[model samples]
Target chain A: MDTLNLEGTEDTPKVILDKENGIFELSGRSLPEDSAEFFQPVLDWIEEYSNDPNSETVFEVKLEYFNTASSKLILDILSDLAEIEGTTIVWYFHEDDEDMEEAGEEFSELVELPFEFKTY
Target chain B: MQTQDLILIYEGEFTQDITKAVLSMAERNMDSSGEESSVKRKVFNVMVECLQNISKHAESFDEKSKAKNNAIFMIGKQEKEYFITSGNIVRKDSVDSLKNKLDKINSLDKSGLKELYKEIIKAGKLSEKGGAGLGLVDMARKSGNKLKFDFEPVNQKFSFFSLQTTIHRS
Candidate 1:
């Protein structure tokens, strides 16, 4: 699988998913008019990636902000990643932002995917 | 003509800069009072997100009205509480989705919201337009209050979004 890299704009965030390293990352902000359209491909790639079953996958998500619809898509990405065995997700948040930390912890609860929370 | 503590309405070029200036003005006024200052910041953060959301998501109105895609964002305090109001234009087709998100968030309690927000964050997708599906939920949590919104029909296809949220200072 080729690396998927999407740049962040005034309204959207940057997403860089490395296939070889099995380290997929999506950061910055996201809130597009057609969210389903934007995220569909990313999800599709994840689906294909999961099938190959990498030995270990490291997914990193560091976002300053995003919108409600994008929130749903985040779940879709993480849950799909979880399906692949031995995948580890590193969720990072600002040290002071309890909300972001809580968000990651909350997301961790919903999925059995192995996750580690870190603050920087 | 009536004079309250503050009254400001601007449209056209440099709209965001002007709106932010007015925000700072409010902050300066409340600087002397501690509780009021923190509350004002909370309200101000919400107001910024509200305005930015409008600027980022609003479609077509900036061209039609020649407002430069600017929005009307007002912040005022009364009765020991602060009220932040914002308005902007968006395509008719997009209104339903926006409303649904707000409605869903408004309906959830802390725990319910925790679950719902997580699902959206982990499973949700990103749009090219630059949002991660996190702003509104962050707004709701930050304010420690529910978000209030209104969408008015502007044309056959576009609707105006007016969002209001208030913060009380103890």
Candidate 2:
């Protein structure tokens, strides 16, 4: 699958879904005013990637701050990953950011996928 | 009034640019004051919800009314907590539902809020404005406090709606 790279903005996260280089990560703040519009391409990319996923997919989510809208879309993205076997989510949060940690935990509980929590 | 505790206040239309500017300003103020990362996240979360809520729902009175698309946002620092307050114009007909939503959120306890959050996200009901109706719940959950709100009638068709969310500094 072709890589889907989107640079981060003040209200959107940086997304890198490069199958060739084996890098799948999203990071930064994600509180776009139009989250659905902002995340549509990402959702589409993930859907296409699902058809021929790698042997083991380790998607990283290193968001500092995301609004509730983005939170729901994050869950959707994780759900998509859950459908693909051999997929693990690497959730990174700031050391003192309890809310982000808890968010990751909640996503782990809801989705049937392995999650590794790391603090930066 | 600009008091020592008053961090920032904005009143006018809520364009995406204006929202970003105000949020960054508040963030800078919080960072410079040496606020803990956790507490700052809570405040930032609540502020974003409040401002985005206004941007999405604030009703314009009429094409010619001066209050069209106008709203107010204020953040202040008290000794023990930070308060984020927002007010916007809304149609009088929409007041009841908005009030009910706030009341329901304020009445819930922590675990109750967690359950509601989970339920709402699972339901995945995204509004036309790109909201899942989770803003109020998220604000309540992040702040860990009851949402305070009021509505004042502006005219027959519209009212001024105000909401306040508080995040403790501890």
Candidate 3:
């Protein structure tokens, strides 16, 4: 699959999904006005990537903040990845951000996937 | 009349640009107040959800009100807690549902709120405006307090809805 790269905006997050390199990243803040529209393509790409089944996938998620709408879409992304094999999710949070940390823990509990929490 | 504790007040149309400006202003104010990063983050998070809620639900009032697509947002501090309040006009029909939602959210404890948040997210039902209807749940969870709100009838067709969330500094 071709690499899907999207630039982040004031209300959106940056996304880079490289199938060949097995690197999937979503960083920055995500609070788009229309989250479903903004995340539709990303979800589509992930669905397509699931078909090929990368040998090893590293999903890096470093989000400063996201609205509740984006939160649901994020869980959708994580749930999709949970079905694949050899998928590792790296959840990043600021050292002092308890909300984000709890968010990571909640997602960890909801999904059956390998999650590594890293604080910056 | 504005209260002495008022730190920020914004009344106007809520666009993406306005949201960014408000967030920046609130961040600067919070920083200057010498709050810890965690406290500031909580305030910021609650503010975002409040603003977004207004932007999503705010309806244009009748000509008599002279406020078209305009909402009121205010941030005030009392002692060690910060209060964020937002008021907007909504269709009369939506008042009951909105009030019920807030009541349901306010009744939950932290764990209950967390469970509701997870359930809503997993259900994946976005609003017509593409929201997961998790804003109220998030506000309750982040503030660790019940959401206070009221709905005042404006006219037969519209009502003014107000919501307030409180964040304690620790």
lDDT over C-alpha atoms for residue B74 of model 2 = 98
lDDT by residue (A9-87, candidate 2, tens digit) is 9999999999888899999999998998899999999999989989899999999999999988998999999999999
Question: Each prediction's TM-score against the native?
Answer: 0.62, 0.96, 0.93
Worst 10 residues of 1 chain B by lDDT: B1-10
Error of 3 at A39 (Å): 1.5
In model 3, which residue pairs have backbone atoms overlapping below 3 Å?
Answer: none
Please, what are the lDDT tens digits per residue for candidate 3 over residues B29-114?
98998988988888989998888888887998856665556899999987779999999999999888988888898788888999
Residue A4 Cα positional deviation in candidate 2, in Å, after optimal superposition: 0.9
Going through the candidates in order, their DockQ values are 0.19, 0.81, 0.78
| Best-to-worst ranking by lDDT | 2, 3, 1
Least well predicted 10-residue stretch by lDDT in candidate 2 chain A: A93-102
**Interface RMSD (Å), each candidate?**
5.9, 0.9, 1.2
Cα lDDT tens digits for candidate 2, B1-170: 53339999999988777889999999999999999878888998898888888888888877686654589999999888899999888889999999998899988999899999999999886899888899999999999999999999999998999898889998
How far off is residue B64 in model 1, in Å?
11
lDDT preference between candidates 1 and 2, better one: 2
List the candidate numbers ranked by DockQ, top first: 2, 3, 1
* Chain A TM-score of candidate 2 vs. true chain A: 0.98
